[model samples]
Target: MKVEGVLVLDKPKDLSSTEAVEKIKRLLRVRKAGHGGTLDPFATGVLPICLGRATKIAQFILEGDKVYQGTFELGIITDTYDLTGEVVERRPVPELSAEEIQEVMQGFVGEIEQVPPPYSAAKYRGQPLYRWARKGVKVEKEPKRVEVLEFRVLAVELPRVEFEVYCSKGTYVRSLVHEVGLRLGCGATLVALRRLRKGPFTLEEALTLEEVERLQAEGRLEEKILSVEEALSFIPAITVSREMARRIRQGRPFSVSVLGSLVRLQKVARRPRVPWLRILSEDGDLVAVTYYPERFSGEGWAEMLRVFVS
Candidate 1:
């Protein structure tokens, strides 16, 4: 039997995100699986793996904020901006005042423009910039606007600094570290990185590969699998009448008048910036991901982005 759910994997170091998903697939013996975020080979923690139907929600998961904790070495710059790349530049470590470093990073707390590292997976002309950087090709990438919700220095070792960051999706910590060094006039490079959270999932709730193997050996692997409903628990669910649920199951969009007393436009979606809502069947099973069209087409109905009826 196939299972549809999400697994929060505490990935071990030296494994790519795709490789981690493959390990989860092998452990569960599932044919279809996907991951919400990508972590570098040297990074670890909170990689959300979606199995079966949960794969449909991977993009939604990717849109959520992420938290990371890592250490960077001062006086060093690498081609990739991390320890994995060759040293491209080095500078003497000047005396850094605690207050000065804090103020510089604080400037990054709000929205800022960030130029991705040349040796990154950012696409340019339909090719990842990393490939071009590998061959010593030059590509000028425009800085993108990203939100850094929070950033704080945890420890200040002379040559290494440990820090934590909470930022919007696609915000690259390596780039952030490199930029900090640039501002200090001393190049820096990331030595270690671990993501502590992604979206609503946290590292504390993730199962390590060894733990997963042990559970499967004991025939209790299902204990770690989060049902599709639980995986989307971040989104509020609204129950629909049987007639409306039938229309959703049949992939037909219906008028809002058919919805009775419990349904109201403001109750389900009140703002013009509403993204998506959970539509449940009469039995409360999640049937489809719906969105109010009143904000767009001025229509009085919920449009289905994807249906999950089974």
Candidate 2:
């Protein structure tokens, strides 16, 4: 059987996220495959690879928050923030109390301005920043607002410190490390990093590329393929009658009165209460994802972001 769904790959270090997806494509012999989030070549951990129809939901996965555990070495700053780049500067480690470090970390919490690293994939004037960096060109970049939900120093060992961060999408941990080092009055560079979680997926549930290959060779690859519905379990669900499902498939809006209870309950639940809804056919097959805005007028309707038929 053809396999389709998200595969949480425990990306190995030294392999770019793209390379890992390529390996999965080659292993599964699937022409369509994409990763939800990008991991630097030197960074490793939970990289979600979507195969076949699962690629349609990759954007939603990418929009979710990510958690990472990494170690940053102080007294040295690198061009790439991580060890992949050469050290461009070095400074003496300033004497700082643990309490001081914690206080500085607190400042990073909530919404804050973050500047993307120069040697990054961020674009400038329709060109990748890395492209300019490789050509010995420096471009001034504007700082973007990124939320840092959690920033805790897990351990401190003189020049090397381990930290765990839970941040919004697009928050660069490499730039974070560099900024934190500057806050401590000492330069720093990311020495090692591993993503522990992304949205609903965690490292504990991830399978390595080697294990996936083993499964494929044994003709058990389907066992690892989660259904698209299972992958989108985080979204709220709304089961539609067969007639309503047909109407949806025909691109017609259904009566909102049927979901009256859901709307009322969601009003009390307030914002960020899974605004998206999973519309399922009477037979329990997923049809599409619908978005109902706040104070949703009965005239407003939910559009299908993804449609799945089993």
Best by TM-score: 2
TM-scores for candidates 1 onward, in order = 0.90, 0.92
TM-score of candidate 1 to 2 decimals: 0.90
Model 1: lDDT of residue 37: 88
lDDT of 1 at 161: 87
RMSD of 2: 2.3
Angstrom error at residue 152, model 2: 0.3
Error of 1 at 115 (Å): 2.6
Clash count for each candidate, listed in order shown: 0, 0
* Native-referenced Cα lDDT, model 1: 0.83
